[model samples]
Target: MIKTATRSTIFLFLLFGFLGFSQNKKNFSSIPNILQQIIPNDRIDSWVLVYNSYGKNQEIRTSGGKKDYTPQFSGFNLFPTEDSFYYIAYAAGGKMNYITDLEGLRKFVGKIDNAEEAAIVLTAEGYMVDEEFKDVAGNYYEDTANYYLDLGKLTSKECPYQKTHYALTVSKSSGDVSKVKDNGTYIELYNKKCANNPRLLKIQKKEEPKDDPKKSTRRK
Candidate 1:
């Protein structure tokens, strides 16, 4: 009788385990459908792994406070004949980054083996992970919620730092977390949090240069 009871318990545990796994799959089914459509093919085999990683990990994590992972992913179809969406992928092996620019170029952020967590490290140092972006094709994807701290943890005077349009087209040079007088790094401002953040509002108050540095000083 004891043997039978043990066998039944083992069976029930496995049954519930399988059900829980299936439920998790059901929750993330949409991610694959959306990502697969615009995934690039330059590194076909590696990108396959990234897709699998997305399926397994479909959520973001917060640590400490607002200083965790916040690398923005931005891109669109470079051309109608090709499909290329740029973003950072967190995988069991590590993170795979597809850095995209406004010129419609897509390339790996660094070497596959040595590139582990490069995006997170760079962003933490003030360098924007994304290159430049124009999401005309709606391929500009954002994996992070852009909220470093949860609502319950926020103080009364503090407000969540919301990314404008999910920071889709924002880009900055390596090691540039602060503002420069004439650095051409493109930035998307917060549409919602400026009212609550006086410092951010002051940054927004900077007038756009009439000369258009991107057109005059920068190259295409």
Candidate 2:
């Protein structure tokens, strides 16, 4: 009788353990396999994971405020013919950091193997392009030339709306972020029309001169 009771207790424990393990596995598998591999289990549980067809967005509330995690290629229209690039972003504390060149992402997520394959899986989810800026006068513009002009006008006391659109486009290409430039027309427009604005002047000062001063200014 004693032996039978011990055996019965052991059997029940094993059965319940198996069931619990199976349930956890099922829950984990529900997430995209690539994400399941990339995000650590604890972080996955604590963060609210939001998924769109394009990629995953994780939001976590810290003592400071909310932080968002999204794909590296966000805000750009990805062409199907382009090489697959993969990256992760952590945005919080008024700053955004991209993880691609280093092993930080893999280490943080606890996944080391099959990174390229995982990126392909995530990219397969979708392509995204952000919206362009539109002026109060109802004109839509892509580059920043008209954007800053309209921005200055809107911020003036004369305009009650005081609204302007600003956004950054970041893309990952061959394990590095791509360089984005304003259209030449936008640059010329900003210089001619909005140069007087303090903000515009600050931006212009940051631009490096195109020609080498020593070469161009030398007696010729």
Candidate 3:
């Protein structure tokens, strides 16, 4: 366990796509017009919002219009940790639509004590409502603008105050995560999009081995 317990922490809004995690903006009720401008396409089809705070999980699921979800996650304990919190989401074959402002979430999490990071887990398919974790043990994480976990590189955008770290991730198929890397910009691997189906992005390996050629003696 990564130990995501932070004090004086508050989870504003958490969005879950079949693939990515997002921050909820419902709290910006005072600035309705402004909020819309910030997140023009905040709402999407077959999307859900998972907001956690004060030891509870709140979700809002919808096909497109009406919202349906649980007010709180029962039996799950979400204690505030050192600038951190915990959350869960569903992955429909690793394909989903996510709407959020990564920079905003990072800023919000950074404000809380010990709240410099976050994580997301896409449980095994066919058991969306089941509380038990069915798939692998490790979970995806997003500290600010980066996403990582057991798997390699996921995303690397930009976090609050320019902080970066591993967070949550979900894989539709069973596999192992090796290493994570960033090209000094975007998270190339996780940001990939395909038509008609979803695909897992991976880091390209070097064609040549790391062994020093000069050290090798000529074959006699």
* Predicted candidate 1 versus true structure: per-residue lDDT over 79-128, tens digit per residue: 21133333333322344334334222223332211111222222322322
Sliding window of 10 residues with minimal summed lDDT for model 3 = 122-131
Q: Would you list the C-alpha lDDT of every candidate in the order shown? A: 0.31, 0.34, 0.28
The C-alpha stretches of model 1 lying farther than 4 A from their native spots are 27-84, 87-98, 101-220
Model 3, 90-120: lDDT tens digits are: 2233345232333433332232221112221
| Tens-digit lDDT track of model 2 for 1-220 | 9999999999999999767643432111212333434444223322322222335443322222345544554321111223333444555345665555324443444432333222322232231111122222112122222121111112232312232322212222222213322231221122335536666677788885677778877856
How many angstroms is residue 148 displaced in model 1 relative to the true structure, after the best TM-score fit? 24
Q: Model 3: how far is 35 from its true place, Å?
A: 18
- Among these predictions, the greatest lDDT belongs to 2
Among these predictions, the greatest TM-score belongs to 2
Candidate 2 Cα outliers beyond 4 Å, as residue runs: 27-83, 90-96, 106-220
lDDT score at residue 10, model 2, on the 0-100 scale: 100
Model with the higher TM-score, candidate 1 or 2: 2
